[model samples]
Target: MNQLEQLKKYTKVVIDSGDIENITHYTPYDATTNPSLVLKAIQMKKYEYLLQKSINYAKKKGGLKNQIVTNATDKIIVSIGAEILKKIPGVVSSEVDSRLSFNTEKSIKKAKKLISLYEVEFGIDRSRILIKLASTWECIQAAKKLEQEGIHCNLTLLFSFAQARACAESKVFLISPFVGRISDWYSINYSSNKYRSSLDPGVQSVKKIYEYYKKHDYKTIIMGASFRNIKQVLSLSGCDCLTISPELLSILQAKNKLITKKLFIPKKIYAKPIKKLSHSEFLWLHNQDPMAVEKLSQGIRQFGTDQYLLEEIVTKNM
Candidate 1:
């Protein structure tokens, strides 16, 4: 078997993109989309029709320009996600607004709204949709509430064990611990010798979470994301899932025959209890870990800025 097939034996591969056309070629099990990806897709000549359709729908609603723009943007993202589901066999994660990260109630409300748009407006089933949320404490609380309501969530932008532990405790549906971003931070802070690919800080972080989940039998799935290269991807061979960009997915597909398994059943290895943190402990952890804090904040702001840009596109078209 090729590497892709070998990886699939142990991990469920997910396509991380907004372009449905590209995703069909790789045949990933699931797919994920965020505002930035959706915006990038709509900018392409082939997807301009998606943007135009959203604007035309907004104009028909006969509301204030801002309201029309907001509705249009939401509609476009939902539409793109719905289209992606047609090509991929598994779930499609649709993200909520990043600005709502700190407000639990608002986050839950927005998540419900997004689900409603996908199910009621676009006719996609809820079972195939995973509402994506930031891995903030407030967002975790919001996910807990949504989970109880039978709305599954994909806890995203996760950088540290603290975030992963909290999500697992809340019984989240899945957690996406970023691999490449963590690798990037370690590369800058530590010397070259300190950062081997096998011992990559990012890979270690995901391994820690995977071991913890297996030790406790937590059902929250681990999906590694944001890979910068094939090494990071190979390091996470047996994760529950890995949401890979088209660039990396292409590389994997080309070398499918060479891929080898690195991670399998965690029980064979030693496992330990995750050190639980109180609120103050969590705060201190966040403060002491400069990389986690920086990446968490940066990820939120970048996604938020992309969301605003998407809003602009919808408005201009309207």
Candidate 2:
């Protein structure tokens, strides 16, 4: 069996892409998309139609300029997500506006609105979606409320164990701990050639979180995301889930090699519940971790900028 086939024996492969055409080849179990990816898709001629349809949708709504643009943006993302959902048997994750990442109330409202759009416009059920949110303290709280309403969540831009622990405590459905970004952080701040996949800081971060989750019997699925290479993917073979890009997915598909699992939850670790992170504790801990502080803020900025650029595209096309 090829690497992907062998890897699937232990982990579910989720395609992290906004381009629907490319996703069908892998037969991924689930799919994930973010503002940056959605922005990239809107520029492609093949996916441009989804953008146009969203503009038409916004115009039909006949709202004020700001509201229309916001409506169009959400519609376009769901437009792509709806298309992706049709192709994948599992759920498709779609993120809310990054600008609202910190506002718990707004985040909750946006999630509900997105869910409403999926149900009303696309006829997709809530179960078929994972409302992707940033791992902000407030956003997690928003998810706490959203989860109660039966809306599942996938927390993205996660860089630290604090984020993972909090998400697990909240009973979140899944948390995407970015492997590549954590590696990138170490590469910039503290580089070392000795860092192979086994020693890679990013790989170690996910491993730590995975072990903690298993030790505690946390219900949240640990989905490793933002892989820099196939080695990182191979290193995380036994993860609960791994959301991979098409580039690496194809590489795994082509490599006819056996993949040994690198991660295994300890057979015996005393299981105990973790206390939830309070607002002050969350702030100090989040600020305490230089990498998480940098990456989380950096990720939100990049996504927000991409979202604005996408809005620009919608206005220009209309």
lDDT for each candidate structure: 0.87, 0.91
Off by over 4 Å in 2: 192-194
- Count of steric clashes across candidates, in order: 3, 0
lDDT of 2 at 15: 97
Give the per-residue lDDT digits (tens) of candidate 1, residues 1-318: 666667777789998999889888888989999878988998999988888988887788878888888888878888899889889888999999999999999999889888988888788888999999999888998999999999999999999888888898788999999998998988887765546678888999999998878877788999999998888888889888999998987777778456667776665543455555566766676677788899999999999999999998777776
Minimum summed lDDT over a 10-residue window in model 2 is located at 269-278
Q: For candidate 1, what's the RMSD? A: 2.2
> Residues 49-74, candidate 2, lDDT per residue (tens digit)?
78878888888999799888989999
Task: Give the TM-scores of the predictions, in the order they appear.
Answer: 0.94, 0.98
Mind sharing the TM-score for model 2?
0.98
- Model 2 residue 263 CA deviation in Å: 1.5
